[model samples]
Target: MNDVLFRTGGHAARITLNRPRALNSLTHDMVLRIDAKLTEWEHDPAVGTVVITGEGERGLCAGGDIRAIHDDARDGDGRASAAFWRDEYRLNARIAHYPKPYVAVMDGIVMGGGVGVSAHGSVRVVTERSAIAMPETGIGFVPDVGGTHLLARAPGELGTRLALTGARIGAADAILCGLADHYVPSAALGDFVADLAERPVREALARHVRQAPPGVLAGRREWIDSCFAADTVEDIVQRLLDHGGPEAREAAETLLTRSPTAVKVTLAAVRRARGLGALERVLDQEYRVSCACLGSPDLVEGIRAQVVDKDRAPRWSPATLGEVADADVERFFTPLGDRELGLAGDGPLTAPGTAGPGAGR
Candidate 1:
């Protein structure tokens, strides 16, 4: 079956992610097709708006097909996974910059690649059912698809906590973190979608949008800001552990469960992404980091423990965060030689030995 379905009527073109059992996890082909359809719709005078939704009540998307990535990493060369990320990241950039109104209906669980497609859109709609997150650290990978770009810009160090813990947030927190725009109740979603088929996105949103239920992040911001502000992952963990609050110490425990290398690399990527500024530049940086992850033992083991083996206990290489050296983390940022994603549209980043202007470091 087609993993994605497409149709157009009235002023809008719609795309639905169709793999319900797997929660609409994206495959490389799905990424390519979505990009092609967007390119086609961009030029069509009848398509004033573009809407994306998932087929199931479960969620919009879970993430990339990690089972496929696990197989590729364990048995095949890493090139296929890298190629998939290359195209997926490009599609994310297109969605962010797309000229027409791009409306993403984020209901139920959305994570990783789900956040990639929805959070970057011009108009992001969330529901009471929305449980949004990047959650890449849990799978021994850093956030890609402009996630670091969005995370780095969130208020204070809230992004830092979410990145390390791979925590899920509801609609209010998502809006507070700039990951979503308006909130509509889950019951209103059907009418909201029907309205999008005939009216402008703003008008459709106006009809159904309502205040989101309260989120927990705002109350925890004090501790989240203080604990996650440290420069290094170890320091961040230390701060969390030192903080007296039950939630703060709980956050520390959650960090300890993550892949040490992945956590360190994530902290580095998000910090560098903050400096990188532009979404394209940050995405270029993410491509390098993601490709480096394909080479890591943790990426395979994490997926094995979490997804394949269903063990929930990942034996991360190096075993502890203290063992992950600065040099080791830096390797993820190394220029990809001739294979660089170069999405900055200006110039490639300089060698690791030298950090140039707008280097996106």
Candidate 2:
């Protein structure tokens, strides 16, 4: 059976991630197929909106197939991992620029690569079951697939708190973070998506959208902003510890649990992405960081412990935050020359006649 299934009906085109047992984890082939499908749908006037969802109750996607990443990074040269990231990051950029209304049903356990495929879309819908995050730091990897772009743009340092702690936020917090657009109760999703196949996106959303339930981040922003605003990971940790709130202290302890190198590199990546502005540029930078991560000992070991061995104990090489020098973090940002993703739209626009986003809606 296909890992990703595509179909067109009425005013909508659909892409369903079909690996239910794996929480619909994304793969390189899935990425390529989705990209090709998007290209085809973009030219089809019959497709008024494009909708993406997963097949089962678990999630739209858990993440990329990191078991493969572990094997490639551990046993082979890093070229395989690099190619996967190249196509994957390009797909993320395309979603950002897609002229059609791209609707992502971010239903459950959306994390890592899951965020890439869903969050970049123009219309992101989260259900009560949605647990959206970019939890790469926990596995000795930094967030990629335009994750830094989305996180960097989040209000204040809320993004910093989420990135460093690898925290999962619900529908309310996801919308608060600008990671999602609307909230639809999980029970109503079937009808909501069914409506998409028959009506314009605006009409379908009007039928089912509701305000998100309350979330924690709005209340914790005072502490989160003050603590995460520090220049370095070391200072951020210290601020969280010094704040004296249980949540702040817990966030500090959470930082201590993640891979030191990964957290440090993540902090730098998010900050740099903030200044980088365009999503395409941030994605280009992310491609560099992701390829650099493939070379890190932590990437393989972290994957082995967290996913392979199921030990949940990663022995980060730098061990402590201080051991990761300024130079070490800087290496992640270094360019790959000809290998650069070049996703910055140097060429002509994809749809000159298209106004994009709200056009067909």
Best candidate (score: TM-score): 2
Clashes of each: 0, 0
For model 1, the local distance difference test gives 0.89
C-alpha RMSD (angstroms) for model 2:
1.3
Model 1 scores worst on lDDT over the 10 consecutive residues at 352-361
Model 1 misplaced stretches (Cα beyond 4 Å): 346-361
Clashing pairs in 1: none
RMSD of each: 5.5, 1.3
- Per-model TM against the reference: 0.95, 0.98
lDDT of 2 by residue, 121-179 (tens): 88999999999989999999999989988899999999988998899999999999999
